[model samples]
Structures are given as C-alpha cells and as structure tokens.
Target chain A: MRLLYFAWVREKTGISSEEIDLPAHIETVGDLLRWQKTRGEEFAAAFEKDRVIRAAIDQTHARHDAAIAGAREIAFFPPVTGG
Target chain B: MIRIQEGDFDLSAEIEALKDSRTDIGAIVTFTGTVRDRGSDKVIESMTLEHYPGMTEKELARIEQEAHARWPLQASLIIHRVGKLLPGDNIVLVATASAHRHAAFEAAAFLMDYLKTDAPFWKFEEGPDGAGWVDARETDGAAKARWSAKSSSKEEPAST
Candidate 1:
C-alpha cells in the first residue's frame, strides 16, 4: 500500500509518499495511525497532533474509523484550507 | 471539465472555451482565487499549493458532478494550479454556466464552498516572519454545512 502525506504532515514526515507492506494488525486508519506513532522520531512528531490530521482512503475522504482493507493509497493531511 | 495544473491560466480563453457556442447558456459565473500578499496579517513572500494528483482530479470531478446534479447546468470548469507560486498569482478558477442566473450563481457558490473544506489542496505561506501551513477555518466548514440543509429541502437527490 502507498501512504501519502501532505502540507505540514509532509514537511514533518520528511517524505511525500511511500509504498509499504502494511501490517495485518492495521485493519483501520485508526490502527494504522496508532502503529505509525512507533516508527521513529519523525513519525512520532508527525503523528503527535493526530486528532487534527485527516485521512483519505483511495482518494475519498474517510473517517479514522473507516476500514483500510485492499486500499491502494492512503493520504494523511491536515484539514483542507483551499478556496 | 476539471483541470489540476502547474501552469497559469487565461480567464478569457477559458470563458471562451467553456462557452463552446452553447446558445442555451444564458449566465456564467466564475470565481478566481489568488494568492494575496498578506495572510494571518503578515506579508507573504510566496505561497505553495500542494495536492494529490489523482486524488485532486477525483475530488474536483466529484464536486463538479455534484454541482451539475444539483442544478441544471450546461457546463462547469475547475482549474486549480498546484506547486510553488509567487504572491498575486491565480490559484484556482471555477466557472459554471446555466440557462438561468440563479442556477449559475448558486452552483458556483456551492462549488466554492465545497472546494474550501473538501478539496485536498493545502496552503503553505512563506513570509518575512517565517513560514507556516494555513489552517482550515471553522467558518469554511460552516459554509459547507449550509449546502446540506439546502439539499434536504430543495436540491434533494444528492450524490457525491
């Protein structure tokens, strides 16, 4: 699966997007977010303010409680501020 | 049409292209968002708009489709520019055309309201005092909320 980060989340994570073998235990975005917290210092900092962060599964806005099964891409970012 | 691009656009040309000899379209409403030199009360040097490529297109298409579904529109266009840009550059353009003034105006407003809170684009402002990403405003979410009330009452058969 490919995980993408944008805006401040991208700046903090130090990378835009990456493909990884998602852990089976991470069935939902909430679970994936919880596991990402343990990745390292950068991941820790990026996930530090987790609640304000939003996610999109396969390009659609998804709730943290949404399942991530068979998802090709998951993008995490702050709430959108475009016009 | 939905376009997410890195290049600046010509509004007149876009208006002309969207017209496409459609005699049925009596009204056209467009909203162009630009990078003002000031944000958060600070003078901005530059601004960067970041977005997901495929996802951005998908979202814009969804928004455009929603507008068309809600209103009987002849045409609609969304042109959003991504990547680094200087102050005063055009950031996004949304144009909608319809047979009636009310539909054109309301549909454009609806598109803009959704774009503010739902679109994946994020804004980062760089200025003399330092730089920071623009935070989403509660007011924007509030603006988007009204559409739901509208759909439940008037524009009923909604699909995202």
Candidate 2:
C-alpha cells in the first residue's frame, strides 16, 4: 500500500509518500494511525493529534473507522482549506 | 466542466464557453476566490496552493455533478489553480448558468461551499514574518452543512 501526507502532516512526517506493507492488525484508518505512530518519532509527531488529522482511502474522504482492505493508496492531511 | 491547473483562467472566456450559444440560459452567476495579501497577523506576499493530483479533479467533478442534480442548471464550470501564487492572483472560479437567476445563484453558492470543505487542496501563506498553513474555518463547515437537509423546494426549476 502507498501512504501520502499533505500540509503540516507532510512537514511532520518528513516524506510526502511511502510504500509500506501493513501488518494484519492495521485494518482500519484509526488502526493505521495508531500503528504508524510506533514507526518513528516523525510519524509519532505527525499523528500526535490523531483526531484532527484527516484520512482518505483510495483518494476518497474516509472516517476513522473506514476499512482499508485492498486500498491501493491512503492519504493523511489536515482539514482542507480550499475555496 | 472541471479544470485543475497551475495557470490562471480567463473568466470571460470561460463564461462564454459555458454559454456556448445557448440562448435559453437566462442567468449566469460566478464566484472568484483570490489570494489575499493580508493574513490574520502578517501581510502575505505569496501563497502556495497544494492539491492531490488525481483526487482533486475527482472531488470537484463529484460536487459539480451534485450541484447539477440538485439544481436545474443549464451549465457549470469550475477552475482551481494550484502552485505558487502572488497576492491578488486568482485562485478559483465557479460559474453556474440556469434559466432563472435563483438557480444559478444558489448552485454557484453551493459549489463554492462544497469546494471549501470537500476539495483536496491546501493553502500555505508566506510573508516576511513567516509562513504557515491556513487553518480550516469552522464557518466553512457550517456553510456546507446548510445544504444537508433535503429541501426539495430549493430545487424548483426556474420559470423565467
């Protein structure tokens, strides 16, 4: 699976995207956020405010409990500020 | 039509294209969002607009389709610019056309409201003081929520 970070989340994570093989336990967006924090200090800081950070599965906006099974791409970002 | 590009768009040409020789269209409403020089604290010199490559277009198209389904619109267009932009530069444009003024006006507003919250775009402001990401406004969320109620009355076709 591919993970993308945007805005402050990107800044904190220090990389825009990465390809990772998720462990069996990471099945939901919330689960992925929790597991990513344990990867490194940068990821820990990026997901510090887990609720504030938004997640998208397969480029669609998703809630914390959204399933990530078979998703090709997942993105994390702050609330959108576009107009 | 939905366009996401780094280059600025011509409002007049876009409106003309939306019209496309259709004489039945009675009203056309447009909203343009521009880069502001002043932020909450600093005088912003430039702003950088970032967006997801594939997702941005998809989201915009989805909202545009929703607007069309809700309103009796003759045509609609959305253009959003990304990358570095100076103050006063155009950031986004939404134009809606219908047989009556109310539908055009309401659909344009609806599109703008959805774009603010649902679009996969972020704004970063830079000035002499410093640079920071623009925070999402609660008011924007409120604006989008107004359309959640299934108000069939608002979707009435234009008689004029």
Candidate 3:
C-alpha cells in the first residue's frame, strides 16, 4: 500500500509518501492506524490524537472502519480547513 | 458551465455569456471573492492558491450540478484561479442564471457557500513577517449547513 501524509501529519511523519507492506490482518482504517502508531516516536505522536485526524482511501474520505483491500492510496491528515 | 485559467476575467463578458440565448432567464446573480490585504491581523502582501488537480475540478463540478438540481437554473459559471495571487486579485467567481430572481440569487449563493467549504484549494498568505496556511473558517461551515437539510429531504445528486 502507498501511504500519504499531509499538513501536520506530513510535518511530523517527516516524509510525504511511503510504500508499506501491510499485514494481512490490517483490514480497516482503524486497524491500519493502530499499526502506524508503532512505527516510531514520530508515528506514535501523529496518531496519538486520532479525533482530529482524517483518513482517505484512494482519495475518497473513509470512516475509521472502511475496508482497505485492493487499496492503492491511503492518506492521513488533519481535518481539512483549507479553502 | 465554464472554469477558466488563472487569468483576470471581465465581469461583463462572463455575465453576457450566460445571458446570450436564454430568453426565459430573467435573473443573473454573481459573486466575486478577492484576496484580502490582511488576515488574522497580519498584513498580507500576497496569497497563493494550491489545489488537488483532478479532485479540485471534480469538486467544483459537483457543486455546480447541485445548484442546478436544487433550483430552476438556466445556466451557471464558476471560475476560481490557482497559483500565486496578490491583494486585489480575484480569487473566485460564481454566477447563476434562472427564470426567477430568487432562484438565481439562491443558487449563486449556494455555489459560493459550497465552494468555501468543499473546494480542495489551499491558501497560503505571505506577509511582512512570513507565510502560513490559511485556517479553516467556521463561517463557511455555517453557510454549507443551511443547504444540507434541503438536500437531505430531496435526493442529492451524485458527485462527479
């Protein structure tokens, strides 16, 4: 899967896009997020407050439990307030 | 519907284009948003707009279609400029034409409201001190919320 970060997420994650091999068990947005929290201190800090964070699967906004199968892009960012 | 490049537009030309052939169209409502000189009390010299290329077009097209479905609109146009913009430069434009003044006015306002909240563009303001991203505004959310109830009762159009 291709993981993309933006705004404050990009600031903390320190990189914009990365290729990740997800475990077969990570099937939902929440599960993917939980796994991201274990990557490093930066990843942990970014996902610490998930309330303000938003995830989009393949550019479409996704709920926490949205499926991730056959997904090409998973983007994480702060709630968009941009015009 | 027409969305243009980041070039200055003549208001009369845009309005005329919508009114050309439709004799039934009785009203034309337009809104033009400009980059301000200041934001959050900071003096802004310039503002730059960045947008998600494919998604930005898709979102704006959806907003236009929604306005048309809700009102008896004859025609509408939305032109939002991207790239670097300065104070006094036009940021966005919304124009709606309808058989009645009310529909034209309502649809034009609706388009602007949706654009503010749903558009994919990001604004970065540069001032004497530095540059920073523009914050999400609460006023925009209120504007979009007004139309939500009506949309819920009526079938919402599929977004592009």
The residue-by-residue lDDT of candidate 3 on A17-51, one tens digit each, is 89989999999988988888999999998888765
Candidate 1 pairs with clashing backbones: none
A1-83, model 1: which lDDT tens digit per residue? 99999988998899999989987789988898888899999999999877788888988888878899989999998888776
Q: What's the TM-score of every candidate structure?
A: 0.93, 0.94, 0.81
State in Å the error of residue B146, model 2.
1.0
Q: What tens digits encode model 1's per-residue C-alpha lDDT throughout B10-124?
A: 9999999999977878999999999999886899999888887887888888888888999999999999998899988999999999999999999999999888877889888
Per-residue lDDT of model 2, residues A1-83, tens digit only: 99999999999999999998999988899999999899799999999888788888888888888889989999998988888
Q: Write the per-residue lDDT of candidate 2 for residues B45-132, one digit (tens) a residue.
A: 9999999889899889988989999999999999999999999999999999999999999999999988888898999998999999
Worst 10 residues of 3 chain A by lDDT: A74-83
RMSD to true structure for each model, in Å: 4.2, 5.9, 4.6
Q: How does each model score on lDDT?
A: 0.86, 0.89, 0.76
- Fnat for model 2 comes to 0.63
* Residues B91-148 of candidate 3: C-alpha lDDT, one tens digit per residue: 8888998888999998888888787766666677889999877766666666778886
Tell how far residue A78 is off in model 1, in angstroms.
1.0
At residue A32, give the lDDT of candidate 2. Answer: 96
